[model samples]
Target chain A: MNNNPYYGPEGHGPYEMIDIGDLLLEDGGTIPNCKLAVATHGALNAAKDNAILVPTWYSGTSKIMEQVYIGAGRALDPAKYFIIVVNQIGSGLSTSPHNTGGAMTGPNFPKVRIGDDVRAQHRLLTENFGLKSLALVVGGSMGAQQTYEWAVRYPDFVKRAAPIAGTAKNTEHDFLFAETLNEAITTDPGFREGRYGSPADVAAGLKRQAKLWTVMGWSTDFFRANRHKALGFESVQAFIDTFMTGYFAPMDPNNLLSMAWKWQRGDVSRNAGGDLAAALGRIKAKTFVMPISHDMFFPPADCEAEQRLIPGSEFRPLASIDGHLGLFGTDPQMLAQLDANLSELLATRVN
Target chain B: MNNNPYYGPEGHGPYEMIDIGDLLLEDGGTIPNCKLAVATHGALNAAKDNAILVPTWYSGTSKIMEQVYIGAGRALDPAKYFIIVVNQIGSGLSTSPHNTGGAMTGPNFPKVRIGDDVRAQHRLLTENFGLKSLALVVGGSMGAQQTYEWAVRYPDFVKRAAPIAGTAKNTEHDFLFAETLNEAITTDPGFREGRYGSPADVAAGLKRQAKLWTVMGWSTDFFRANRHKALGFESVQAFIDTFMTGYFAPMDPNNLLSMAWKWQRGDVSRNAGGDLAAALGRIKAKTFVMPISHDMFFPPADCEAEQRLIPGSEFRPLASIDGHLGLFGTDPQMLAQLDANLSELLATRVN
Candidate 1:
């Protein structure tokens, strides 16, 4: 119903909303009348063992996950597994900062953590769907953070897990990078401390944020090799103006800030009193710690460090010059590699 | 003198100025009342063969170059050679946007290029010092850009050249990165299109820029290893607030923008009718193209590609986790390696 095309049923296609009521956030905030936006494909079996959960990433929704990852013949085959793509809490499709009413609207929205997203989604699967265990839990970036949280928080619930292009614990470097993005929005005079009448009011800040992404989101070689031309960008500036801006502009700024705050503090270690290895040790699910080569956000080294802590987890790297943004499925080669790896993981036997 | 502590003779030590009025810039604009801030050490031998030129990098002055690189018995030994550190145009100590008054002051300052800085320094050395040739022309980062320009533009003038942690032609990625820095300054409401009352007026924008530097300026390992603690910062935020902000806050925004514009378009290729290989091949000096191992700004690959085109030039990679900021001389180990390589480069006979 909002002007933002990327929000609501208009952008996300047909989806169901589950009102989870008042949800207590990990950061001591509350999301009153909290609802989960979910899109499902295929069918659940009598035992519900065929169910697979795929969470949305930052600035992404269930529709993008379905389009880019889920398919009839792909590793995330809807024909075999009942796929559920759940929009995270602050994503505009859900009961988010933009969509919420009264005191908890826009900049006044309560801070929700990654744990909060997991708990909300946990309710949807258990209470609404009557699902006891999931066949696999796969996600990329912020979605991957949720996938890791799911495996660690509720070990027996997730049989298999693949967290792609993400780390279990966000690095200090990434926290600072997110701060730049936040400052880029809040510093705009028109933003008025996020009370802007329209998203366009903070256009300068949003554009500046997009410029920072030009350097960090993609591998240096991607720009060096002129890969933007392959994506139909005549030049880098065209890529920035047309592609990056187009992707971010339609989304609500408050929704992005909410997601970014959660992304910056993404850590499963809190579940085990800040002992990352101890937290990861609790995971019984067969895990594939998939990191994209040249990913600046969560580099292979960062992901591999956490992967080593997860007992029996494989450190799989996807090759893409798109870096952390390889999750967007820009490079067909990287997607194909990801599909092959996921297929192998899904086929493996797990308790 | 300006209130900015980083500006004027107070911050840069006692330096001499040579007025070379109305210098025409490479971009067809002219720097009215052009002056070069210079500091010298040792004496130019009767033959003037022991003279070395060390140009200032971006946000750098002659004093910094002296304190970090030059010493009594170091590779840049002032006692053994006549060392001239010429502060680049737009660098505050020289005639810059902050210090210059009238029509071409502040944001109205003319566009400068790497070629303009080289030309200005060339005038200082040739006209004022009566130098026939230089023993060596060496610099790091933006200073490296000028070093490359000096070697390419005045082949016979520089006998030996070392361009460290920089490319001859700026990359598309770097151009966009510079744009982000520029926008960080301009987007602030207090900036008022570069008519800000003081540098403090753009504090928010500059702090945002410092956050961007926190991600890109240093290597990922530097943060992962908690190297900030070694530098007396208890936390990353403390390092950013205390060190990064303190470094940039004292400087004028317009001066940064002016230098950044020059840095973004740093192309010696323009000299050879847009043929980078041809331009680099024009270097007659014994060249050493050195890149820091983890320098995201100008990666080793970028520098090596250009170095390969320069005949007789060695591609030397300095090991440093400080990355692009290795030019700041933070790591003693990196400084030692740099000093050793420079010593060898200076000792080699070049006719």
Candidate 2:
């Protein structure tokens, strides 16, 4: 994974990292010398109650979130509250297959679950930062999965939660979709059972993977309206050739496979003997279950079904033709609505 | 495709083939020694005007159409009308990559067009059957593309038409989706630039393609409602392993790539200097543009846009949780509705 130039020192911006020692995984394996890649804004105030925890989504790092969602006067203003964006376990910037050493590197990397990432984040807050509870727990996609994990597993610690464009339990349709993503990478004989010498070895597979993402990552209306042009792409093929491939070109294939595995098994329902309603009923936090109207990955209908189960939770749908990727701040109107909602949710006092 | 057991001499029941001789392709290539596989039901009346034509869809042969859509009491009853089911070029039963010999075999197969299939079928009807005009022309998906081409290119020959679950002009979304399918096969190292020794060599690629199809082939509600159980599969994985993989395991990779290329370029608007409305207006046939309500491949809205342009056409949407695969006769209610629609369509008068 380190052989890839995209995630190397020259490609990505610098971020803080702290070794959390040996981290036990949910799948009965251990990630030795596990480290959490971190980025912070503002200060944790004297009361330490103004800290907002944001976790990275699939293939996402802390940097993009800070740039897109956080700003001076925005709901996540640095001057008003301390915000921590922690990269997920398998994300390239964190303790992933590419950066780990010895047996824990590459294909030998152990399977990490959503619960494991939440547990690590909990440790980071309590042990290192001396924080007792979070002002808010929010994320998009897989980060949303982690948001739900935090709310359900440690309900008391979370004051307010917003899981955007994701489901508490991954649907069978999504599980199968992730399977295709995994297969697209592994089927490239260049993959060689995840033991390929470098990222270039699996270029064909990664390209295929990127193409697959284009099929479902955005809404049908997005393509029908030629929305790619707004993104500075002259043609759909140009957008696919430049943007889609460029996005996946930098990541480690094995790290992606690991993240997909965790994404397929995202089920907070496991906390209540596979009862989704019972599990969501445990959330004491003020919750806003946000779903993108055009998101095929986690449709608003699916998100609303779970929201109905969570007591006093609001089902807030962000209308955008960008689909699940609306969370990337693609639509200015959607971003504005998101900021307004967050502001209102934050202002409301939590018990 | 002949090398694969699924379409081998013993595997497939039986079908008739007619040599169309060397056919010039729309792309300026020639399909030397071209032959089309055909299956027929019922007998032509002495008047010879009670004839109907049906073209095969992407990866479909004439046999499945006869089994699923035609029966003694169905709209396509053999006793009432002479039914001709012509397999499209590149489909395994037709002059596909595996079946052809000499330079045209395998990867050397020339690019085919929907117009080419329509032209070949026209020749077969006029030359072999001695027919003046068809009573109706009906098909699903890619077959529907050919159906549209036939109605527009040879407007006088088709008296009535039904293009089900397809659009006259392939949208950018569908074009991009088809690209992913093509890449899935070509990216496999075992594919070896379409020179794989046998089907087994490209098993990984075909499996990936099959998985990609499942992502959009069936609607979200189909999976969410556990519709696969009615198909006799216990779980989604079981359905994918046996049904999805089995569907593509025996086909030639090059053959699929050829068909996908043709499917992506389906555009009847080319007949009218890229004016879609003018091209559709050329259709004199009494037409019913049928789209499956849940079809993600060719959504109802896309179909309706084209349907509105065709003069004296009805926009008919088939309600099914099965999505585009509703054409497979998966839902009994949907099948009954299809039969009813076809019956009404065939009974309509044409000038």
Write out the backbone clash pairs for model 2.
B1-B98
Please provide, for model 1 over A1-351, each residue's C-alpha lDDT reduced to its tens digit, 9 standing for 90 to 100.
224656768778789988988899888878887899889999999877999999999998898898899997899998898999999998998888888878888988999999999999999899889999999999999999999999999999999999998888899988888888888887877888778877888787787777777778997889888889998999998999999987777667888899999999999999999999999999999999999998888888889889999998998899888898877888999999999999999999988
- Evaluating just chain A, the predictions reach TM-scores of 0.98, 0.97
DockQ of all predictions against the true structure, Cα-based: 0.80, 0.72
TM-score of chain B of 1: 0.98
What's the C-alpha lDDT at position A20 in model 2? 79
**lDDT values for all models:** 0.88, 0.88
Number of colliding residue pairs in model 2: 1
**True-vs-predicted CA distance for residue A90, candidate 2, Å:** 1.6
| Model 1 regions lying over 4 Å from their true place | A1-3, B1-5
C-alpha displacement of A351 in model 1, angstroms?
1.4
Error of 1 at B321 (Å): 1.5
Off by over 4 Å in 2: A1-5, A8-14, B1-5, B8-14
* Per-residue lDDT of model 2, residues B1-351, tens digit only: 247656643554467888877788888888876788878899999999889999988888887898898889999999999999998898888788888787778898888899988888888899888999999999999989999999999999899999999989999999988888888788877998988988889998898888888888997789888899889999988888899999898888988998999999999998999999999999999999999988988988899989999999999899998999888788999988888999999988786
